[model samples]
Target: FGDGSFTGKGLYHVDAFEAALKNRIDENTILSHDLLEGALSRAALVTDVELVEDYPTRYSVDASRHHRWARGDWQLLGYIFDPRGVPALSRWKMVDNLRRSVTPIFWVLACVAGWTLLPFTQAAQWQALMILSLFMAPTFDIVNGILPKSGDQTPRGHFSALARDTVFGTALVALKVLLMAHLAWMMGDAIIRTIYRLFVSRQNLLEWRTASQAAKGGNDLGAYYGMMYGAVIIGVVGLAIPVLADSTGAFVAFFFAIFWI
Candidate 1:
């Protein structure tokens, strides 16, 4: 559903109350509800209204919900790509949702590809690539550091300050990434399963979980591993493949697999 309505903060968090049921919405699904609502409302009023949700307490529960959401978002591919009479804005909304759902899949694929090609790359090439990647993560910070303090349009010495800031920023980024390791694994888990159900197994595309269903007894590593076994397998193999390679591919893939553990 294409519309100009502004959904506050998050579409799931807040939106208009009034809604109309159409005979058929070209774009439809659990994830597309807000977009469809916005499309039908035709510029509904927006107030500084706060909506609160009694979300589940368990992290696994939350992950389960998002996993379902990932499927719902991927289901919109047909509507997004089809040349239908749907509004352009609606198509774009679907595209955005699809992009979010598909990014993790692409990330995992790239990881696999990187590992597969690692054996062919020279040691110098792989080493340089690794160094360049680390530096590129803080490219913006490096660029900002080029300019000294205000009114100090003076020439910087050999970009020393910029280089220093880049290294520090990259370290901070690496730390932040490590902290969110669990989240990254969960996201990848959701999308991979979404794709499997959507195209591989061709089941559970519309299956959703209630709060009660999502609730877990407690945190159990074995049970956790059961649900996230795919990520685990990928992580183990991803690391093994790089280490097995002769080049410095291990350095390139270490960060990718390290957080999974």
Candidate 2:
């Protein structure tokens, strides 16, 4: 697709070559990952050459853009279980994509569980364990995306590395807490839609939907509020679990949910 137009995030970073080298691709998929997988299977020489990409600005545009991407990445799952010529690194990347789809769901569950279960459950240790599992899954992904090689640069001691990852991870998440809930909803929707497609309607897996904003702006405030209504409602509902039933253990979760609102 980058026979060159400033495409979205991943496409701009695609590994491309002329027609002769392009013939290495097995499937005619739109995703750069798919294309890269096909090329890598055929032993193509690869290198990193950064290029400028046009990041989507409008929220609707950005969401629609990533929705297409989520579909594309999910489509790679078939290769994961039945490895056919895909390299080890590429295969693991497919597994990582699966984790990405589920990570948001884990985040939502963590917030809900921390707010509700952690406060009232007598099995305090178990509840905290579950909450930590759900909470840290998204944090690991966040930190991984921000610094893929972070593990290598950590101090030599094992405990020290973990402590640093947690401290830095919490601070970083707090900075983007506002967007975290939105991302959780968006990626959760992607996971649900992907599941439905896998079972019910296998067609249109490759369909690409671009965000359209052809109409000129007038009172975008109404449109803006209309879009955010769901988020506001979710924040209010999620907060209720901790706000009304506040406890010592739930305070951490409550504090996070305030920014989430």
Candidate 3:
């Protein structure tokens, strides 16, 4: 009973794991924990496995690791859907696995889109709902952090870290979503082609890439903070403009400006 780092002998019993790898056709394709988990689930071996908490102490390393994981997940989408390689799982299981893999991308998109559209729509119901949802999300995370048996111990700098993560993490995710969306819009074909080569064409998928330069060694710290602070300002101004000036156009313009940053 263990997480993806399971090095014990029990893993050898999961025939689907080896089958998935062999079916890949390309021997050099990089393997990921998600792929193994999906394979195990598809083969009905999930119940036999156990998971444990493994948290990273360094934020920079964790960010880099997550970036690699996201890329691996995107790449796995191609293999899972391809008829040639991955062993066929039940339709329901396959769909569920795919959904789980892309959950993060969907979440970021939803947050960005919701915030961007909120001003223009001026829907009070939606505004209330968004506020409640955002508040609940972070509150839940904070509660989870302090809960007994949770992976993350209460940090020594608990309040500061919690506040920083809540604000910076939201800003960072918004920026990432906007960047990815812009790239997709501007270089849709090129991006698609690259994915095809890496996954479908059996090109090597083991390259390491940094997710954000700003996250590395506090490089360009000023610029990063400037952007984050700017986002906060824009969000505040966007909401305030509508109430104070009673101008929908002003509210929308400021809201849209947030994405431009």
Candidate 4:
């Protein structure tokens, strides 16, 4: 709304809309897709809205933008459940919004839980299997994309292509997962703090600022590369863990590896 990314386009009555903004909506709410869409949906104005091609053109810029949007979604989640005078949104709509709102939280928790559980499981086979699965999980889509369609290519050609795809895809996936985990951790921490300030401590939302503009200037890139390097270090340590002949050494290494996750 501030950047002309969204416009009313004369779709609703001007006076009613202005009154809603002044009285119903929280002025301090972060300008976000969820806030706008949720408010409109709750008001039963589901039609005549259009999404424009206003996305950032660069990957770095897009990532930075999404970082903020992720926080905004978390903020919206509080609004969804608050006792404040939000309109009666449909149950299905609320559930959908809640899922979208908490995606980063869920991802962060899943990664942390996966890492936390790794050390406790007694079965060595299961541990190895889980590691292998993480490595292989991101390759399925690439393999599918590169596979030759029926009657389209030679079997040998498909096999060669698949081998190449697997190699590249696995590396890319590993990098992406590690970076995403780091970003999720950063975002999740911010969201948690914001929740604590806004709801748990009963602070005024208008006075709260979870992240300052200066802090965000380079965190997106920094977190990505920092996590990637950390993953590499952890992977090296994990590879060396199996070489330790003693069960106690292996056990400690196992916990260390899990802690890395």
Candidate 5:
């Protein structure tokens, strides 16, 4: 704490001195002078430097009590710490963290199950079902991530801002996914080449490629290729099975695709 008395004394002196100085000072500049004096008092409240084992280092003054009195100016610090003085990463943020963790699981499971189950119900619905399921994964992922937890308490203003950001962010993600899927549909080989490019860009994939190349170059290409190929395989198989099934055969095919396959 700025020598507890110094902060108060400084403010008092500033007000008194400024009141005397005001007669000679232009009224238009009084606000600027008041701000300067307030800053000086704030500085006096804490020593210019604190010594730890006699080594001088800049220090922060305890301003929790004064922060509430700072009006609109101090509200900015609320971004750093809430009214509880706990930062955003604190355990008190349980609701936000819980929602973040649960969203991915919920969306992944829903899309996986839907793809695995829905296709066999109607053979004619193969194209619609596969494409819907393929797109649903990313769509649901983005939606759940952006959606506010019904039970969570958040500042109304912050939540509104977050909703606005989510709108634009989700649109961008959807656009990317659409373009990728379109390119994949138009040219199957392009997807594999794009995977190579993706492998180069993503550090994890690059490491996987290096390890695989070291282990057995060209020998286990099938296994190495299958890593990125799984998603496309799932989608293509989902699309193909319905084509092979008869009108009523799709019922059994759906069960095989979802549960057995």
Candidate 6:
């Protein structure tokens, strides 16, 4: 590709590589395309190098390094590529992710403290602050983007990105809170829909048509029974929330919300 030049061949090759990667990865994989793209975009922005136009410099790094050093470079790239690895809590990578996510929570707490000390503060204001803290979970993503644990050579750019991500993550969490509140208000409908689909609809459309006729000469009681039974199941789910289950749910929900939005 023009000896690492960012001309015709190099640009085409870069695009092809990215496209090929998109085709290869499973949509459900822990290290997803979205995560990779975000990481790379931040990398490029922080490095002050366009992936295409800056190819020469990066290739120079590759060329200058000892053959053995390639392993470390590849490992860092691999870690960034893997979702399971990027946000990994058991390693150094997690330290940055946690730091980024927690920064906003700390900021919010500081604000709450100031508010508490204010002469005009009241009980209602404190209650509002408590509700606001619920969205702290999403703030981590902002922190991750801004202060990525995967330290490359972009400290100044990282802080700038961190500031940007902090604002964006806060906005995203605010929107999610609104959506969750809406969904929670209609939590009964969600329960009903789950019951109908899982226990009622399938039976009615397939085997239960004949069974309903034989049992009562008319309507199928499975839907009603299923709905009743589902409530119990949902209640069990509610009970599971007291321990590790809720924490897991919160992590999942935070990511799911971020991805969809």
**Model 4 misplacement above 4 A:** 1-13, 19-22, 33-54, 57-59, 82-175, 200-261
Model 4: residue 101 alpha-carbon error in angstroms: 5.6
**Which window of ten consecutive residues has the lowest lDDT sum in model 5?**
58-67
For model 2, how does the per-residue alpha-carbon lDDT over 1-261 read when each residue is reduced to its tens digit? 212211232332235434334554345443536434443423332347576766766766676666667777776666667665555666766677678766755766666666666644442464446445545655765556554355666445555656676777666555445555666666767767776776678655566665555122223867655544555556666767666666554555555556666
Looking at model 2, residue 69 earns an lDDT score of 72
TM-score of each: 0.60, 0.58, 0.45, 0.47, 0.22, 0.28
Best by lDDT: 1
Query: Which residue runs of candidate 6 sit more than 4 Å off their true CA positions?
Result: 1-126, 142-152, 185-187, 197-261
Q: Candidate 3 residues 147-230, lDDT tens each? A: 345447565566666677678657754545444322222233323544785747766466564444525555465644443353
Sorted by lDDT (best first), the order is 1, 2, 4, 3, 6, 5
lDDT of each: 0.59, 0.57, 0.48, 0.50, 0.37, 0.37
State the displacement of the C-alpha of residue 5, model 5, in Å, after optimal TM-score superposition: 32
In the range 103-140, model 1's lDDT, one tens digit per residue, is 55554555555655655355336434534554554786
Tell me the alpha-carbon RMSD of every candidate: 7.2, 8.4, 8.8, 8.5, 22.9, 19.5
- Greater TM-score among 2 and 3 belongs to 2
Between candidates 1 and 5, which one is better according to TM-score? 1
What would the TM-score be for candidate 2 when compared with the true structure? 0.58
Candidate 5 structure quality by residue, lDDT tens digits, 1-261: 222222222325657666644544223312112333333232344446553433212111111111112221211222224323322333223334234323433433343444444554443365344445445555665567565666565678547856766676657554433333222222333223334433354222212122323334333546433333533554446435544443353453444334312
Local error of candidate 5 at 13, Å?
A: 31
- Candidate 4's displacement at residue 102, Å, is 4.7
Residue 48's lDDT in candidate 5? 68
Candidate 2 Cα deviation (angstroms), residue 244:
7.4
Of the candidates numbered 3 and 5, which has the greater TM-score value?
A: 3
Candidate 6, position 178, lDDT? 36
Give the poorly placed runs of model 3, Cα more than 4 Å off. 1-25, 37-54, 83-128, 131-196, 199-204, 209-216, 219-261
Best candidate, TM-score: 1
What TM-score should be assigned to candidate 1? Answer: 0.60
Cα error, residue 96 of model 2, in Å, equals 1.1
Q: Which is superior by lDDT, 2 or 6?
A: 2
